[model samples]
Target: MGGVVIAKFLCMAKARKEYEAIVTCTMGCAFFGAPFKGSEMAKVALLYSSVFGNDAYESLLSFMRTETNDTLDEVVSDFMEIREKLVPKIELFCAYEEVPTDVAYAERMVNSPKMSSLTQHKFFRAGAKKLMEVGFSGLPGTHFVTKESAVLPGTHTIGLTVGHADLIRFESITSEKFVPVKMALTSMVQTARINARKRTSGQNLLSHKFVNQVRRSLEGVDMRQKFRAKVEQRQTTSWLTSEPQYQQWMAIGDSAKPLRSPHMWLKGGPGLGKTNASLAAIHTIGQTQLQEQQTESAGRNETFLAYFLCERSSGYDTAEDVLKNLITQLIDQEESLAQHARWFVPNPGYRGAASDDSLRSDLDTPASGAKATATVDNLWQCLQDMIEDPIVSSIHVIISNFHLLDSGESTTALLVKLREDAFSTVATPRVNHRARWLITSRDDQHIRSHLTAKCIAVIDLENDREYGGKVKIARQKHAKDTVTKLRQTKKYSSDLASYIRNSIESQSEDEKWIDSLCLLLGAMPNNSSSLTIRKWLREMSRYSINRLVDHARDTILSQNEDLTLEIDELLQTLTIAYEPPTLADLAVLTEIEDIQQLTELVRKCSPVLQIGEVSEDRNKVIFGHPEFRDHLITLYHGDSEQRKRYHGSMAWRCFKYIEKSYDRGQNGDAKGMRSLALTERIIDDSNVLVMANEDEEPDDAGPQVKRPLSVARTQSSTSIDILAKDFQMLRVSFSTTTGTSGAEMKAYGANGSEIFRQ
Candidate 1:
């Protein structure tokens, strides 16, 4: 018999949002009973309409109007294709059929105490009303109906039933109502096709949104730009490729064969170019990937590379930032992994695994605070899962400056786990794709303890004669390049250039010596004679880089007494800057109105700080080498309190600069202003934290009165210029020795009042 009555019931149930009942009754009526062929098709059409939403029905007419010329066979083929696409989208509809259908007892079960609570549910009330309308109205023999309920053979008829006339007669729409039958089938297939595509498109957009959200939260810096700069500068690590340790570390086997040693730890002293070596390995891997793509090999193993270069100056110092950066790189290589990371983007504080329940929990949990960042443990878990994905054939992870990571235990564990998995005695399918780690760092005790295992290989750059020779050669080349540039300056004559070149060659092995001599010779006044140049060479050759830096510090302090305060302020500002400030940035921060005077003062302090073009051709006054900076910091801020005091002084200068320069009434940058306000708050809070931890009581001098910009530069003992005009809204984060977590800064004003306290 036709399912006209069933279709009516489904429509009613759908109106009440009774999707479960519509799905259940349609499947039961169409599949169980000896229903007419046209009736079954009609019921299926109604099922698709109710489940797929109004758009599903509307799309059918559009499809039919455009496809009138298609053959019956072509139409059927198209319908089957659409059905295949819709299968995943309607899995829940199919699931309803598997429920045991004991229709005889369904009506009675509805009256049970267990169902009492559900009686108040919308679907229950809707069914109750239908039952009341069809009281004892069903066909007497085949179907049953009462004031409380109605029962059909194939479905648990809540309160709706077929009439006696509907049971006896079969309405064959295929024969008598051909148009209706054709329209029903066409609409059902068209609806499936349109809805499937719509759902897929919607899901794709949502997935991309999730990926973007996670990526933004990561705050990952692109190490590729830094890598490119190293390569462009001719800082080659090609020599590393020749080392036996390097050869073995970079070696890989087929999927069936395990990695002999997947972990490589490159330890060295500072300035040994370990970071460049890691970048070389990454560059080589990239070249190999490019070659593979060009070859179009059918069976080539896909290799994925994820790397993070940790530099404290760029805010990549914490273990959390490391893992987050690594995860970001991984997502870049395998975009689908972002779907996994999406679960944690809403609440990075949620450390649970990615599951339906955990995802719900993560979404439900609110972010802990305004600055709530991704947690290290959660990122670690996400990274581990990504590496283990079956689609990834091989993965190479390179982390440079591992020692710079504040909390590296999690990273250490991940490396260990990868190594163990690569060579595990117990074989597993997931181990088919293993991760290899190449870590470069100083010979820190913590790193040594973790990576000095029998299975891991450590390459000591300090003792490697070949590596040392390469470094010496590189240094000599750098010295020659410097001399060539100095000769071009015309400030040095032929004898002076030859003498400097000979001195550089003789001390190529002493990097600091070459570095110090280069700075001294470069900074020599144009009027200096050969005797003065020889005197400077004697002084440079007599002392080590450390002693030279100490001597330079003294020389800076021993300048004209009138310029002593100005020179000291300049030194302190340079020491506290995150990165070397440009001349313009320095001028604004130092409040040195005359660029000519600032340039002369910078040249006078050249032995301690040298002006050089660092990335992007921007000339900045930087230390000759990291060693010189270290020496200055040790000399001026050896004690933790002194360092905080300097930082506080710098924070105050940044606040003052923003206060004097920012004009709120004008159409100034709203975003920049907000950033400045936040920076001020962070500086103020940092000052408070610094004051709270002071070991001694403050003097009863109360608060120092505000000073004019001109007087403040010379009179304020704690004054240090940290605010560059361009970096007035720079991010400032500070942590204390008392184990307090880092907070954005706040500043202490002249009257001892806190500015931007919020």
Candidate 2:
């Protein structure tokens, strides 16, 4: 019908001789209409010529014609018989028809003399004008327009609207496959709908600032980066995926009715790779869903993957944090869910208001009275509403370290309620949404007792023989890989390398222990003689993980008294830290003024404190293995005295850092330190201060002065002074009814006399 299409057909036919078959088929197609004159045939022939240029299309039409007799009437009957089969052949034409945008086409129709002659009624004219402005693609819903009521069609267009039909067909095609034609049709259809919605809703609904505001209010960490780091560093094997239990679990999750067994509890001991396995499962689900989103089944169901990693010292150890985190993740994927959190906005003008107090209120603790309970209830209700939203197809939640949840029973009960909402009841044949939960935790009796849903599938990694075998194999492979690399780097003899490999493989199937052992082995001095390596390799298998850690610790501490003290300082600081500290923060906390000095200390303690690059220039320090932290804690034997000293040292260091930054006019650093100090509870109470004279003895010391200190962040503050007087040493203590009391500072004058007491 268009000059461009005719030229394209002529160009294609000239390029390929086999296109003559398409021309024949086009001629046959044109025979269905009016008399087949030469001029008339050219019009229909060119229209159908580009339907399909391949032999398959021609052969199908030929087969249908052969089924009928050679008579003209028989041919026409055959054409009618296969017309249904050939209807989809017009997809390309429909795709071409999308070249003119919906708005453009609407304007053309609105101004057409033919449409005016066909329908001059007021309603028809008005509807056409609306279409010109909004376009057929911009129609909000099926209710946007309708045909004549119950009698004659005097006031409106007849037949199903071409725009609605085109929209339905375009949506189906876009969801079903990735055809090049979809780019055009989807822009005219799907994108138009999205644009219409965007126009109807305020632009701020999708603003980055709005998203960040909601994210901060939830007080949840985005664990995607953390998981990605783990997944990148760890080498995964298919043994876990190939296991029967895992396969069945995956199958059920992939099923249409995943709610039948919505919860999967993966219970294992500390050293096992439960976290690793959970990461792998999340990765697999994410990849599968991403691939599915480009297939026919994509439109049938949508899947959202949300996960949380709970760590005890990371401050993400509460059930409330988990609910908030999952809700945040869900709402991030679906913005409509944010409406449920409207109550959280303390001020009605919060949309554009830049108020820090309001934002901080959202993260307040239970000590704040009824607001805490209200916040938790609101979060729980928001989570429930999200799960019940009909727009959501399925939500897969993968939570690791479930046992670490502070309020396990309450969290478990909330989870059970959420499961109920996702699942169908006898009264309701089915639920519109599904939620699949994959939880990993230690085999704690308390947690097991609370997670007793009949629908829950429990997989115990510790006791399963097959799982144990897989872990052993995976560890053995890991050992071989590590030894192969170490052999080359350490330049060991082939025999010695083989011996080291054998010793490593001979260790237990604990992934953490193997990793720790490998780290220690890698950290061994490359210049060490072959005999030394051989001796260490010989003793490795017989040594338990604790003994190995102890050996490493003693070796590092035996270097020198000052270095030993520095190492102790580093370890103590790392242990008490509320979150993993960057290298600069660690250096400040350890009181190591020199960067090189702190770097050396980190290297010496590499076997215990793992150093990872957070960025190109910044490094984060964390325990290389949980066993090492356990060993250190056991060695301390709950040394409350040393713990208090460590806490005091950290708090004082944070204060000093902030003070120095302020003195240097480094406002950014000062502000950062202030926030960090408050978050870590280094300067917790608002009205608290410490004062003492480290230079004088208690017998002749000056009067002790007490002053109320408020460490709450103030936007306009330029300088801060929490101490009443300049003192060589300060002591602060914290007491709580919640079993969190601790002595903070210990000070001794020149005569070694205790100068202050809380």
Candidate 3:
């Protein structure tokens, strides 16, 4: 109310100064979803959401460092506080409204149409108030101090009911077309009013004109449209692999058990179905929300927001890019918020206020245009503000190919911030009522460490050490499910469907071949898409199923123009990007012309390399799927000379990235030299092992760890002059550090000065 009122006041002030009509009784305010307080439903709803939010936090603590519990504890405490604050506000409003008796409220809620119904709101607000009071006196029926110990499941039916009621309501209506006649009439009435005001009011005195600087200041400003993902085109939710194990994960939002972790990290190797699982889960959320809308429950509304990072695409590599895209998507969902972006927009005219020197100061670049936007500070603030909005019940953000982010201070910091904000909740009665984040990444230790440190829920598809047998069973069932779904598609003829089902059911050995088989099926010829199951079976009858799949894989790798060459390129790139590369960095290396090119390549390399996920335009790439990477490495090592040649190419690229300021260089040169030297060694080493063995140089044997470098300082002019007279060209040597097998590097000049020593 304050923000809207201020904006209107500014408009009114302008109108008074000039004859223009700006502020009106009706402007942007349309619909608002207010959660109820003091009702039975509110108490249950708060508990269920809290439990669901904490589910992953508890489950994944063991996977993380013990110290993370402290961070996780702080987050949970803050969320409860949020609920407490909000419930009271909601109750104060509903107590004055015409709230119905509890029984009538329930019946009224069941029959409400749109989310704006008075009776339905009465129920939600009343429930929220009741829940808030319970928090004050201790859980309404129980006195357990610990959130975990309070409230039994079946004994408290309200938990389930409230869980169903707390979904956030955020819908974009500005995009809808308004009735033309109504709009014309409104415009005419406005014009008539303006004419009357001009005739009856002010004398046209001093010639003074003032443009509403606010509007001009934000000319062409729009953050909502800049970033979006083509998830629908990639393969709607149905394209996802639906296994029983995955089903348990998707059902977490509805479950009463407190989330062991605050968020879920869906871990998997490349191409093993992490994104598909995410998509499937997202689809399920959509369905759940749709059901709520249909029922007019006004209890809960879940809004899904996702950003898939692609390496070959536009701006997905950097920390800043991800933040911008995430914020953009959220704003796009709630069009009313678009106005706030204008408020944040810098007043361009203000630059003229400062002297030329200060205006020219480059230390802090003004984020005034499209190129400079979304600072780290404002990015998180914008998201938090949106999440905390009363109408936005719950925001579920899904980020796929999370490992694609280049390892750096910025990326790490951004991840930490995301983890912290995942716990921000709606105030007073429903704190868990705000947002939760879900990510999919390879099992990279660095990435894992950061998320687990925040006590995030982790569900690794490939990490099956505990229940291998059950996983195998699930895999078999998954394969059957795929076949069943495939049978219904238009591509499968009745005969082929029967034959496929028969072949699948008859196969005695469940070797966990579902994913591979699905990959093979997808990799089949373009003509295969139209091939009836009968024709496919007939073709298969000539050769065994394994042989057929092998042929298909070979065909994809060798004969397919669209896929073969693309896969070859992806294989080579991933092999060289052995360490993760920022999506933008890879794009430059691969010379990717557009996101479609990268998307096409990833599509071609499926079942082998998850390579990366490209967003609508920006691509974020990550190298993973150990098996796929190893296979590529084996091929790369297939010919020793080829491997050496590739290493040489990579070495040259690394050198290009190095800041070649010899005189100004200090410590950073050593780090760059080490990387360059290692690449050189890799090229020089004969018979390079795809998998390191005893024959390999001990220095380059194990996984590498990157240490953040100190800020490089310029050497004194006197030192530079003295060194220049005696110095020769730099010489780099890559060798093992004192205690680790990991290759480290050092650099020297002719004077034998340790120019870069680490």
Top candidate, metric TM-score: 2
Over 4 Å off in model 3, which ranges?
Answer: 1-261, 270-273, 288-312, 316-318, 339-364, 367-372, 375-377, 422-433, 453-455, 460-474, 481-758
Worst 10 residues of 3 by lDDT: 712-721
Residue 665 C-alpha lDDT in model 1: 37
Per-residue accuracy of model 1 over 147-217 as CA lDDT, tens digit each:
21112222221211233223223356555423433444454454344334334434464466666667866
Ranking of candidates on TM-score, top first: 2, 1, 3
In Å, residue 609's CA in model 1 sits off its true spot by 3.7
lDDT of 3 by residue, 1-758 (tens): 12223323434444474623332212221111112111233344445345345454433332222233453344334433332333111111000112122333434554567544643566555654554454433433321111222211111111111221221121333322223223434433433333332222232221112122222322221322222243523344432335543453344334523334446777766555565566666667656656654642222333445454433221444465566666556554544333344434444443223222111224244433323334566666666776665445556677777776645565677777866654442122333534556788888987877676445556666766643444445445555677777656436666665666566545523322343444445444546644553465445445543454445446557755656655666667665553345544555446564667776666555555454445423244543233344344444545645644454454334333332435433643343232212222232333321211121122465655332111111111000011111112454432221111112233556554555421
lDDT of 2 by residue, 33-116 (tens): 111011112222222323323344543333222123243233333333332233111111121111112345445766788877
Give all candidate RMSDs, comma-separated.
18.0, 16.6, 24.5
Worst 10 residues of 2 by lDDT: 29-38
Superposition error at 544 for model 3 (Å): 19
Comparing 2 with 3 on TM-score, the higher-scoring candidate is: 2
TM-score of each: 0.55, 0.60, 0.38
Q: What number of clashing residue pairs does each candidate have, in the order they appear?
A: 11, 0, 61
If candidate 2 were superposed on the true structure by all CA atoms, what would the RMSD be?
16.6
